[model samples]
Target: MAHANDAELYAQWLELLGWLDAEASARGLSFEKVADFPDYIYRMERPYDLPTTVMSVGVNSAGQPLMIAGVSPRHAQLKGVSLRLMGGSKHWHLHAGTRGLLEGKRPFTRERLAQLLDGAVRGQA
Candidate 1:
């Protein structure tokens, strides 16, 4: 199977972040982006004292690129939920820890963003 090139991966990553930003706005959540070299960190602030969810782009232990979401930066690195490109397709697949892929590969959507945020905020992913 073919794999996505760096350009394609970066473009998809930007699109995913944009979708999250829009969703955060619609949901009345505050969103911030911090660039960290090849990766970009995203934080979503919810109302009240709820934990702010952090997400960033990084490679897993296996060296696969993923968009990881979790309650903290460390959590995001160690045990966050991941959205990964499947083959050369312009689609992202949800992955949950060692259990691997959770859902079919698909384009980013509000529903998917919600799921990711929920998992990140709750530290379930």
Candidate 2:
């Protein structure tokens, strides 16, 4: 079976977002932030359908990469990990919306997203 690492997953996500932003930008796509959700959620209506996080967010300019800014999924939360989707309140803080980036999002089916992340950061992507 095929395998994926966190870095690779993140790279894939980055690449995927690059493509999406291109399209959304042309269509005047907008953003919204939601409370209780870390930034990866586009819509909470589909909570059970969230993908896994590959790597923690770094830094960058807005309107560039669609970002779902939020506390790490493993972080402490009263009820557990927050599932905030895009197009809600505080979503503006994110560069790329959660759903925006997740259009093609899915947990690494083969390898772990963490490994992919290591490779990407090492310039293997």
Candidate 3:
């Protein structure tokens, strides 16, 4: 299968981020962009003293686009797990890493985003 070009990957990344933002808003959570450039990072937090979670897009060793999500502070390192873009005709589906073993691969959607955020908030992903 052909790998997606830089432009294609960037577009998909933006789409995924947008989905995340919308889902977060629907849940009444605070979502903010924390970084851009080398990686696009976002933080989602709930009211009160609930745990915060971070989501980031970064290139893997193979130069493929992937997204990482986990509890704040330790998010980037602890999980180190990511959802990689599955190229070819089906460009919207993201292949999960170790977590995929349980959940399997699925397109980035409101339910999927919610599951990820829930795991991150609980520090289980």
**What would the TM-scores of all predictions be?**
0.40, 0.27, 0.41
TM-score of 2: 0.27
lDDT of the structure predicted as candidate 2? 0.32
In lDDT terms, which candidate is top?
1
Go through the candidates in order and give each one's C-alpha lDDT: 0.40, 0.32, 0.39
For candidate 1, the 10 contiguous residues with the lowest summed lDDT are 71-80
Residue runs of model 3 more than 4 Å from their true location after superposition: 38-106, 122-125
lDDT of 1 by residue, 1-125 (tens): 23333334334445555666675555455555432422223333523222222245432223432234322223233222345332333334443322222344434455766775554444453
RMSD of each: 14.5, 15.4, 14.9
Which regions of candidate 2 are displaced past 4 Å?
31-125
lDDT of 3 at 79: 24
Give residue 14's lDDT in candidate 2 (0 to 100).
45
Residue-level lDDT tens digits of model 3 in 9-106:
33444555666667555545555544433222333352322122233543222333222332112323222224433232211234333222113344
Pairs in steric clash, model 1: none
Q: RMSD (Cα, Å) of candidate 2?
A: 15.4
Ranking by lDDT: 1, 3, 2
